[model samples]
Target: MSVITQPTDLLRQQDPQMADVLAGERQRQGSTLQLIAAENFTSGAVLAALGSALANKYAEGYPGARHHGGCEYADLAERMAVERATALFGAEHANVQPHSGSSAVLAAYAALLRPGDTVLAMGLPFGGHLTHGSPANFSGRWFDFVGYGVDAATGLIDYRQVQELAHAHRPKAIVCGSISYPRHPEYSAFREIADEVGAYLIADAAHPIGLVAGGAAPSPVPYADIVCATTHKVLRGPRGGMILCGSEFAERVDRAVFPFTQGGAQMHTIAAKAVAFGEAATPAFATYAHRVVANARTLAEALEERGFAITTGGTDTHLITADPAPLGLDGPTARGMLAAAGIVLDTCALPYGDGRGIRLGTAAVTTQGMGEAQMAEIAGLFAGALRGDAAKTRTDVAELTREFPPYGA
Candidate 1:
C-alpha cells in the first residue's frame, strides 16, 4: 500500500466528486473579483495551519484546565492564539474560542445581560448586521433590542438620538459598530452614553478588525467594555470568532465561551488565527489597511462621477453603499446584473425604506494587490454592467482579474 502524504491527492483518488467541487471553487475564486464587505483571502501560511494535524485534538476546556488529557500541543496552540490576539488588539484578555461572530455576540450577551434585559443596537436594515438586532436572529429573540438608524438627510448616525434612546431605555448594554455603515463608529461618544446609563458597551469590530489592528482605524478597546469580532473578515484568518475585554470581565467571558456557548474549540482555526494576528502586527499590514481605505474612496468617487448616488457622499472605510435606482435598478436586480458580469457584492435595503442599495468593499480587492487605478477600473465595470453592456464589461472584468489574480495565483 502507498502512503497518502498529500491530502489533495488522497482526496482525488478516494473521493473525486468532492475534489472536483473544491477545484471548481478555486477556479471561481481566481476568475472573479470578491467585493463582499465581510470576505477576504487568508494567506497560504494561515491555510496550512488551518489544515494541520491539530484538528484531531479535543481540548474541551481552557488551556491549563482541560477536561481531557494529551493536550500539551493543543494547550500551546491556544495559549499562543490568546497571547497574539491580546497583543494585537491591546486587550487585557482575549478568548479565541467562539465558533463565529454570532457565537461571540451571544457569549458576550450571556456574560453581561440577563435574557430579558434591554439592549440597544443598530437596526438591521440600516448598515447593521443581523446579529446586531434582527428579529430573526437569536440576539433579538432573547433580549429586548431597541434599534437606532442613521439620519435620513446626512446618512450619518445621530448621536443625540442614540443618547436619548439610551436615557429612556437605560439598556443593560449598548452595542456599537456596523456591517455596512461605511463610517467608523464614535466609540468615545458611545462610551459616554453607556457611562451615563450605567450600561456595558460592546463593539462588534468584525468588519474592521484588520484596520484597527493595523492602526489605520481607531481602536475600540479603550471605549468598549467588551469587543467581539470575526477573525475571517478583515483579519484574514480562518473562519472563527474572538472576544476581547478588560481583566474585570475576563473570567466571565471565558466561562461564557467554554461549556456555555461552544464545546471543544477548533484548535486548527485557532492556530491559523495566531498566524494571522502575527501578520497583522507588522508594519506592512498598516500600509495595506490604509491602502484599503484609499482604494474605497477612489472607487466611490469614480462611481459618483458616473452619475451614481453614493451614500454619505463617499466612504471613510473599506466599504461603499450606493443607491442603484439611478441606474433604473433595485438592489437585487443590480446584484444579479453584476454577478452575471463576474463582479460580486451584496444587495441591501435602503436605510429609509426606499427601493434598495448595493454594497461594495475594497478589502478583498486590495488583498489581491489592487490599488486606486484598479478601483477606478472596477467602478467603470460596474457602470458598464448596469448600463446593459454586461458582455463587454464581463470581458473587461476577466482581463482585469487575470492581471490581479486571487492570492497572486
Candidate 2:
C-alpha cells in the first residue's frame, strides 16, 4: 500500500465538509433509537483502541513472529486478545484475524472442506444467513450444499429431516446457528447428526456469543468443531470477526485465515477486540447480556399481544422476528416505516411465514441505558407505526430516545 504522509493535510484541504458530516452522524447515533439486530454501541475505550497508533503497524503473522518488521507492540496486543478470547469462550484455539463474520466463515470452510465438497446448512428464508450457503454467495457457488429447514407447524429445526438429509448427502460439514431465527439452536442435535454422518460441526455464533460468554445462553464451543462469530453483534465490540476451533485444527485454521483468506491482521482491530474481551469478563457485560434477552422477550411478547405474528413464537436471544403481512406490510415497507418513525428495525423473511417480518433487537438501546420500561414504550411505537399512525409513533420514539440519552462520547 502507498503511504500517505499528509493524510491530515489532505482531509483538511479536500474534505472539510466531510468532517462536518461525520459529526452530524455522531449526533444521529446519539439522538436516534437503534433497534437494528446486527448493530450495537461499543465502548468509548473500544473505539479509541480501533483508532489507536496500532493501526499504523503491518504485522503479517501471529504474535511473537511476523513477515514484516516492528511487531513488538503488536505482539503484546495480539497475545492479550488471543488469551482473553480463549478464556472467555473456552476454546482450544482462536484466530482474531478475519475482518468480518463472513470472512470468518470463509476461513473455517477453507480449513475444513475442499471446494465443491458437500455441506449442509440452514436455508435463508427460514432464519439462515447468506454466508451459510445462499446461492448468491461464494459458499453456495463453490460447494454442493443441502439445506434443512424449520418445521412448518413448530417453527423450529426438524432434526429428523436434518438427519435424513445428512445420511443422504453425506456432507463434510453441518453448519448451525442463524441471523434471525428466534429460538435457541439445538446444538446437541446438530452434533449428533454430524457425528452420525462423520462430518464436522460448525456453529456461527455471531449473534449469541455474548449470551454464551455471559452464561445466559448455551455454549457451542463444547460441541462445535469450529465456532465463528462477529465482534460487533451481541459481543458489542468493534466491527470484526473471529474463528475459534478445537486444538486439532488450530494450525489449519490459522493458515486458512492468513495465507488463504486474509493478508495481514488489522492490529488496531485486534486491540479493540482485546478491549471487548476484557469488557466481557466484567459483571457489567453479563448484566447487559441478561438485560438484552429480557428486553427482547418483553418486546416480542408485547408485539404478539398487539396482534403481530412473532416468528418461532418468541425469542431466546437478542432479536425478535415478526411477520407484518397481516397488517399489509412487507419486510421492506415495514423497515422503511420504522426507520421513518425513528424506531429503526431491519427487514427479514421468517423461516416459514408467507410475508416479511421486521427484525429488531435491544442491544443498542440497552447500551444507551434503557431498561424494560423503555423497551415497552418502544414496542408501543412499533405497534403504532405498523397501524399506520407513524407520525405519533415517531414523536413517541423521539421522546423516549431523549429520556435515554446516548452513551456520551
Task: Give the number of the best model, judged by lDDT.
Answer: 1
* All candidates: TM-score: 0.97, 0.95
Model 1, range 208-230, lDDT digits (tens) per residue?
88889878889999999999999
Error of 1 at 11 (Å): 1.3
Off by over 4 Å in 2: 1-14
lDDT of each: 0.88, 0.86
- Model 2 quality (TM-score): 0.95
Instruction: Name the runs in model 1 displaced over 4 angstroms.
Output: 1-7
